[model samples]
Target: MRDARPAALGVRPAALGVATATTILLAGCSAPVQLPDPPVDDATRALCTALVADAPATLLGSPRRATTGSLAVAWGDPPITLACGLPQPAGLTPTSQCLEVNGVGWWSQDGVTGTVFTTVGRAAYVQVGVPNSYGNTGDALAELASVVADHDTLLRPCVG
Candidate 1:
């Protein structure tokens, strides 16, 4: 008597098991991200590249994610992102509250998305965008300030 199994379904049971296992293994894998590149001039671009390259491996106990194009980095699942070579904040004024972290001066503002801190009095403006989930923007800025100061020249110190 001829076998009743369909010829099209001839795949070995072992092969099917292997394929299922492979799929299960890959299900939890996450692809690395590339953030939107902000506009930057030649001078600023150079500084940005240097800053990204020198950024620490971890910030606030979150591992750094791979990034490309202009200067950008992210950490943690919610992802605290930092972008360099951005335009200076137009709203910034002499009276704008400035905070010094790790010897770098930053103008901090809370936005709907999160708290944004921009380097003040630096050769190139750098912005750090911390999601509201992070909760501690000060620590993030403190960890990042050294990297910013390494790449950009400080024009003036934070006043008041």
Candidate 2:
């Protein structure tokens, strides 16, 4: 992503040159993508609970938010990107998928069949999908189970 600064900010030519060079220089560095704060909702909250229960340490113990019909979870560490085939629109091979617990899409376009986890704000996202390999459903199931565990935290305990 390119950072577009205003050209009419009274920036002198020398300053603009410096800014442009600085931008280029910064772009060379691998900077983690930033996402907006996530919103809390019933569904997302439930999901969070399940995730925590499944694997408390897997998640960086950060608050999460709901966004665009999905729960967003961010991480305290640098987000990870992988080729996870998340459900997408039919016939549209998504360039990539991004997951952030705090309601932010954090996936990037890469030609691999793996899952990518991302973090936005204080939350993180763990994505699951079908892999290009065979007979690995057990692994997938285990991953899903871990994610489902967080749901326990997302939802209020049933009155019993």
Candidate 3:
């Protein structure tokens, strides 16, 4: 014996409320938040050279370095080469273990100086000095990892 008039007229407040709530919920879940790109610095040139030298023979020469503020990046393949700069080999303090990622050597300074080294290939390595070195180590390493991973992809395409 329930009334069918409201359903027929399409005036159900509960249905409208549900629709409005769903719309608002979807709006909140729309898109992912993105982090801003790190800045590039003038010293990135040196960093690129060191990294690219390590590229596999197939990569010839392809590392490019760019720096902004305290962050430095080295990228490229084979002969192209890239680097932020080379840190002074003798002056590094409390040197940490060198991490081997995909056969490439990556090192970091564990102090406030925030210096880092990355091997791009067999005979190439690059150094970088970052600002606020203490807090930025993770960011610096992540950036290097991204470049290294990309190089691997270029040299060895994913089959799956």
Best by TM-score: 1
RMSD (CA, Å), each prediction: 17.0, 14.0, 22.2
Query: 1-160 in candidate 3: lDDT tens per residue?
Result: 1211111112224545454344334323432111112223444433343444443332213234322222223222101112433333443223435555444455544322234343433222344333241343444444545455543222222221
Off by over 4 Å in 1: 1-34
Cα lDDT listed for each candidate: 0.67, 0.30, 0.33
- Screening candidate 1 with a backbone cut-off below 3 angstroms (N, C-alpha, C), the clashing residue pairs are none
Between candidates 1 and 2, the one scoring higher on lDDT is 1
Residues 96-146 of candidate 1 have per-residue lDDT tens digits of 888899899888766554677778888977777676767778989989878
Each model's total of backbone clashes: 0, 34, 34
Residue-level lDDT of model 2, residues 52-92, one tens digit each, is: 33442432232222121223222222221111112222222
Which of the predicted structures, 2 or 3, would earn the higher TM-score when compared with the native? 3
Sort by lDDT, best first: what order? 1, 3, 2
TM-score of each: 0.74, 0.26, 0.31
- Top-lDDT structure, candidate number: 1
Q: How would you order the candidates by TM-score, starting with the best? A: 1, 3, 2
